[model samples]
Target: MAGTVAATLLVVVAAYRFRSSRQDRSLPARAALPGNVNQQLSGYTFTRSEGGRRIFTVRAVRTVALKQGGTTELEDVVVDVFGREGDRHDVLRTGLAEYNPQSGNFSSRGSVEIELNADPPPGGSNGRQPAYLETSNVTFRQQGSLVVSDAPVRFRAGPVSGSALGMTYATKDGWVELEKDVRVELQPAAQNVTLAAHDPKSTIPFKATAGPGLEAGVVWLTAQRLRYDKDSREVALRGPVELTQGNRRIVAGRGTVFLDSRNRLTEMLLEDGVHGFETTDNSSMSSAERAALRASPSSEPALAHSTQSGPPAHGTESVPWLPGSEVQRERGPLPEALEASAQRARGIFDPASGQLRKLVAEGGFQADSRRGGGDRKQPSVSRLEAEQFEMTFEGVHSEPRSGVASGNVRLSVNSSATSVAPKAVRGGRPPEAKTARATVKVQPATQTETMTAAEMTFDFRAVGRSLKRAQTVGAGKL
Candidate 1:
């Protein structure tokens, strides 16, 4: 899109200057023989060349010189820009255009359409769709390769499409800016892989495996404005940016995306009041705040955190507990799930496999989870608070394997009720298992355990949904 805009702007400016200069220099001889129009030309064609090679061509079906106004109007204008060695090219078309010789300004009266075709990048397939753009009310500055449009613009490249309220392109500096209400959508290439489920019989829970490819997904993004800098190969999204893919979504105050030499997205950075969320199962949701996500094609995308690994101060020791009745009733509505929020959050992902590797939250971090009633005899809730919390995922299923909480770590586990098995009858007389005297008694009690430590580690069970073991290290209390 950027390349096409730059090339089209350059061609339009050059064509206007060249055509108007030639017409103005020859106008004196035809001044006495014309009305308002000095000369009318049909089938006008202009070409620019460098080093004996044609660079671009401009054509018009008809052109009329306005003798009194020193301006020229063109109909059915088309500009064809040739790339190096003629290996690539772009075509620009518009219904009408006007050039002011005195001010050297060029303006388009109707909508402009541009199509760009370029050779495939290294390692890419030979066949690819051309990029297209459409915009109206375009104007070019006379002194520089700057083009601006106050009207809306739409651009499409491959499976990506975008729109903006207004736009500006600077050919000389290779910069493009979308003024307001920028929105983009990308349809990612499909992968035919299925995620592996946890093995029920395996002792080791959540083994990592490179599973089958995943289906293609769509990514949508919106921002107040967007700017692209060719020199740094970066695009910046400003103010109230949002990105959504599948059930996952991220919102931030600002974001920046870096592109590789091939113009592929390689890395991204988001900051300022960031919030991320994902819907797992049922109607529940997980969310985080003040988070940042960094993704790169070459390495795992990572979430960063501040390090804190120590016990709390000597004066702070009290821990709060929930009532037994409340804990029991809460089990009904709360399903097994995880929730976290912090001053900062970071995540890492496998570039090739597109699997999340790890997530780390730091700076006043807190995480909470509720065990599903179906998974355990006693439903329980666990809460952890510390300077940092880290979770690691492994295997083909992308199941969480381990977690660590560090720096003034405090963990609380609350469970409601326990099941008691019925006793067997001594006499073999048709075991009266359902007898009133043989019935199991219900236990109405809540168990609340709290632990404090410098750091704590958790190992997950085979299903990866439940904790198998947890231990604290360094000056710890239970």
Candidate 2:
């Protein structure tokens, strides 16, 4: 979408070039001319203006008339769009092209290159690379103000770069469409500093390196097709859509990206069977199990007083657990990976930081995790399902701080370790003497715990993002 806008601008340049030639009597017609049968012209230059302001200028090094009233072959074409505006100086260059006056169709014979934001702002292009769009074999329909190409289109602006199989741009309608195989990558790049920011204290601003809103990581997006509606400021991608950033990945049937007027990213909405997960070495588990693990140990007096309880807590431990030592070992390690799915998900962004602020998922939302690492003999699995899930993030890393699940929530945890029964103590005289009482015996048991409620809210620890507190709303059963 970013590159398509530049391609549309280049189309205007091509249209104006032909219009200027027709007005200058340079176009070949059925009527005979002063030159020979095979007439060739060089150093052709034309400029179009309105209201005493120059709009565009076109220059061609060589031109040849193919037939009496057929096509005109042009080579080494250069166009400057909005030259009089001073603020915007978009330039287009192409090796060869052809124009048909009767059909009002101009087509490029070779590769075409367009440079956007060519004229740097006062402080400079903010040390940012100029945005460029490159493609081959494109046709410009002057009658409709449209540009299209069957060849691959590639573009890069600031931190974003992408390629598409085919492209269509409707200048009049203010939209661009990619036919198929759309792939885009966004690496952290400095944005507003160059275009909008300035250092007041110094004569020259420092070289800007910080990203506009995205984190200092690489993100990739792939889709079957994409369309950008300039007037609506929306970019819609046809699924199956896959997005990957760092260890996190999200997939959906479709997605829409919203942009502000300045072309800054604002929000992204994914719908139709959205699923996301983290790819990491650590195993994943649901927050319900984690909350039970952390809260139940302290609440159970038997485990607290039992000698077999887990190791003592230390100040240096990042993840703290209160269960008995044996229980801790049996439970293994806390899960570090997470997986979530829903029918629809929406992500709202923080404009200033360019980071995700909140995420809302609805329609049979479910999150689950499994713990496979640590000292335990077997892995533990946990799951939580609900009608809706919402989470809000905080900090520069965009860590999740809080989450809520509402409407018919179900939480379950399954531990795959052997049960440990408390040891029975015996006195020296217990066996033979009737006065001595017999020690009570208990049986070992393993069980899976499940709880259901109408709503659940979880507050996470800031550092490790573990469940700090959990509360339920409505009658809950375990």
Candidate 3:
């Protein structure tokens, strides 16, 4: 009986083990694959080639492929992008990076550093410095060669360093953009000296020194945003922009900077509610509105033009031409040099040397002058208002050749006092007995001369340090 029982027990135990094995075989598949299948690598490097030439390289201390998602994690990553024929080299390094191979999307887990190097083009500066950038949370699209970061970024290129809230870089097209709150400060290698308007027949005037508030060889620019297109060699600044070069300050709603092939500033366009001012000799100030500044390739430095519409309205606020009692009371201290305003203004410049050649202000233009103010006997202020006004500079020195004001021109001269003879003393003495005592009074008066014509021109000549000759041509009341 005991042997039969033991045999039955052994059979029962075997049956139990077989049943457990069957159950284990029927279990669901594992959620994760083995570690070897994920292909984790150490000191991994990747290269992208085009036309049998390596275009870019990616290196990492360690790379791991996630099992659940086909994403790659890289530690201590470095990426190098090569430009045409390896003339340009750009490097990007980050502590950690995440890459989605299927989508060709890559992003930095933390801050990234980028260095961009470019070879100077033929005939360009030989010592161009590499551009460096530091930013956080960067995303890159490999297929499109686009890199973007919404986080703040800091950049440095030679003497220029700036910070921006956001940025985008397109490697394929060489486009770089700062999305908002862009500020740039530059320390120019050389001072950009420009000659003021002078009399061509006379010797060149002494160079005007910078005022107290102005800095030499420094440029500051602030804007809502900035964009640079390498293909077009153009830079654009969006609204509420301000640019300060030396003592000059320009405020505009929007502006654009055109660059030559060598990345030199060639032209600038300011639009919408544009206002610019510069402190001149003495306490005088020169300011303008609605103007365009351009640099020409010739010997002239730059051309500025401003335009306006409609005729001069009656009793409109006049732009002060010079610093005088009235101008001081109304518009504060005036610029010692020439000051002008108009609806539209245009300036001609010599592109090669950045010299101002000519300036034209049209459409209800006005110019005020206190140039000859030392002589109290002469008018303290002289103002000219017309439909259009122009000043031309000639010769290599950019001397003032002539000026013209046309269309309903009016010239007003304001003196400190006017001599008025007492009314007929002989007859007045006899008649005075009937009316108290005859009173003789002299009061200051403003003499105004108006000229209505299709055109008027003034030829200027310099004598000593003042305007010696001014010849006017027009048929009108003077």
Per-candidate TM-score against the hidden true structure: 0.57, 0.64, 0.57
Taking the tens digit of each residue's C-alpha lDDT, what string does model 3 give over 193-256? 3334433222222233554322444567788999887657668889677666543455557777
Summarize candidate 1's per-residue lDDT along 294-370 as a digit string, tens digits: 12111112111111212223322111111123333433432334545565555565544444568777678776665
Top model by lDDT, which number?
2
> Tens digits of per-residue lDDT for model 2 on 424-452?
45665434454335434343233588989
Backbone collisions counted per model: 15, 8, 32
All candidates in order of lDDT, best leading? 2, 1, 3
lDDT (C-alpha) at residue 211 in model 2: 51
lDDT of the candidates, in the order given: 0.61, 0.66, 0.60
> How many backbone clashes are present in model 2?
8
For model 1, what is the alpha-carbon lDDT of residue 186? 59
In model 2, where is the ten-residue run with the lowest total lDDT? 296-305
Model 3 TM-score relative to the real fold: 0.57
Best by TM-score: 2
Give residue 395's lDDT in candidate 3 (0 to 100).
54
Q: Tell me how many residue pairs clash in candidate 1.
A: 15
Off by over 4 Å in 2: 1-38, 42-62, 78-92, 115-131, 189-216, 280-335, 372-376, 420-446
